[model samples]
Target: MKLRSKIYLYSSVLFAVLLVIMNLAIYYIFSTLSVDNQLDRADAEAAKIAADMRRAGSEVSAPELLRAYVPIEGMLRLYAGDGSGPAPVTSAAEGELSTLKPVFYNEKHSEIIRVDGRSYAFISIPVIWVDGSVMNVQMTQSLESTMDTLGVLRLVLAGTTVFALLPLLLSSRVLSGLIMRPIVQMTATMREIKQSGKFRRLTLDETSKDELVEMGQTFNEMIALLESNYVKQEKFVSDASHELRTPLTVIESYASLLKRRGLAHPELFTESVEAIHSEAIRMKELTEQLLLLAKHHEHWNLSMKVIDLEELVRDSAKVFRNAYGREVTVKVKGEVKGYSDEAKLRQLLFIFLDNARKYSDDDIYVSLEASGQERLITVVDRGIGIPRDELPKIFDRFYRVDESRGRKQGGAGLGLSLAAEIAAAIGARLSMDSVEGAGTSVSITIAAGSGE
Candidate 1:
């Protein structure tokens, strides 16, 4: 269900419950008040009848007739001591009147007396008679009028409850709609953003003063960051690809010359062929590394498993020793075990070892160790160390500390960048420490277990 409809339904039900409780309370209170008033009026009428009886000397005197009339009043009766002789005309049969007792003083009493198959309230008050015998005056009234008034009161209360609920229901719906409109609009806008692949600002009015405004502001900031990062990534890839094209073209041109000229010097041809093959290989490696880095940036899933880092470093050192004609030393200082992709981990170790060889003076120290709960792999080289200002840009694709020397050494400068990508993909931390003209130490730290 929509938020607005839910709010409306919940509020209306709550208001209706309160309304019903209030109406029921009022109905009960008014009904009690009406019943009490009827009884009080009945008591007053009975007292006046007794007073008139006291003033009259005779039982059938005219003074008794002076009693004030009461609404719903019925037959009046007079009783003497011993309770049975000379009863009034409206008195009951001898058997029924035998239940009456003598009234010696002014007192009030009541009973529900049934006669002729109907019920009546008999209100009796005591009075003093002239002959020293106590007499009682009685009057009976029907409860039909009070019951009728109670019935009408119930109808009025029900009518009031219904009328009150109408406005409550209407106001609840309006309030719910007003509160929920901004949220609904924000939801629609987010859906549009997902479908369109571009975020647009939420244009809710400033009059909305609640969490919705805060959410809109946060969404705007998030989109701004996404756009900025996307632009930076696009620029980086474009620049890296552009840099490779020139070297690739040179290699292609040399290959075409060799194919066309068909060995002019024989020895010279062999040298040219080697140069072309080396450049082609370098271009291929650079392109493949760049593509891998791009794929990593776009969220490549690297399957993680426990691998022996000590063995990986030892193997990488052997590869570099053969490839670069350098004396590489590998030391396994501790048990180096962590979760990572085996192939990618080997690729990363090779990148670091290759970079160390390309810059260092033939002696490279590669060590893998475990300390506490962390695995540390360090590649240290006593080479022409990077300058302080150039160290920060070393991880940038196609960046080099000594660009001329790097090109002379046949280096493309993407090895460290690829190493950094691999480190990030496997949840390891890669950092470097260096001193100019002395040496450089590159350290990669991987946590034990899954490296979270």
Candidate 2:
């Protein structure tokens, strides 16, 4: 069932139970009070009859006394201490008189008995005469009238309860709908988003301090982030596809040329083979770079340790100097110690140094400077520096300011992207300063007490 329906059902059931209890309680209390009042009236009537008999002082006959003391809407009977039958003062059935015999013998002061299928309240009083004889005065009042009144009350209560339930259920349903309206809207909005593949936020009532409002706000923020990530993912896929197509087309062309005419023209065979080899190498490098970019985007798995930043830079500079047969100057201003993933830091170093070597013919400078609460690691080279307008896009995947130069240097344009990702993953800031035709300087800032 829907939540609104369930709320209404449960609430109606509870209200129905309460109504039943209240009706039963009212009937019981009213019935008890009515019975008590009837008994009191019977006692008062019997007292008046006894008083009249005392005033007469045995001078009046039993029939005359009963006639004189007859009560309104009631029956009266008198019995002697002798074994004589009762004297009737008011008209009553013989069976009813017989039913009263047991009550008299039992000496009960008051009782309610059914006679001839009609209910009666009987009150018995004993009378003492001056002659030492005893007499019993019995009075009875019909309960049928009071019972009819109660029956009417019961019917009225039952009818009221039945009529009240319709409005109760309807009102409960309306209240439940009002309560669940926000959730219903949220569900519809989610369905629309799923169908259209669009990120749309929920318009909430800002004045309401309910949890549903908070949930709507949070959901809007989550969709915003997902949309941003989706846009970036689309761009990455487009760039990767464009980068892969050229090398693949070149390889396929060279392979086709070799297969068609290489055996006939031995001179053409060498050129075709070389072209195929070069293209294959390019494809291999592009594939590796794409895999690296994908891996860094997914999750960072760091093996953190403390290392001397100065020593690490010196080691990387030595490797660079040996590999390129060029001088790599290392300058340290202080003892730079940091806690970081050593392998990832080495990879970042390789990217910067390799980029410097590929672009610049001048000697490379790797510097580490420590100031208050921060350490700066910079790679400076006198290269064909990036244009100011192109610098912002340099860290974008497969973006190259000089595409031909990058191709000649075997650069897939992923080194700076990978470096930036690694720096972000390790909680460092990577920045660059370059002047076209003068030099380029790339620096990574490591906060003091970071990565520990």
- Which pairs of residues have clashing backbones in candidate 1? none
Weakest ten-residue segment in model 2 by summed lDDT: 97-106
Instruction: Write down the TM-score of every candidate.
Output: 0.59, 0.63
Clashes of each: 0, 0
Estimate, for each residue in 116-173, the C-alpha lDDT of model 1 and write its tens digit: 5544567877666677766666766666577777789889989998999899999998
Residue 431 in model 1: lDDT: 89
Error of 1 at 253 (Å): 3.5
Over 4 Å off, model 2: 2-164, 175-210, 261-275, 296-301, 371-374, 384-394, 401-410, 433-439, 447-452
Specify the poorest-scoring 10-residue window by lDDT in model 1.
Answer: 89-98
Model 2, 216: alpha-carbon shift in Å? 3.9
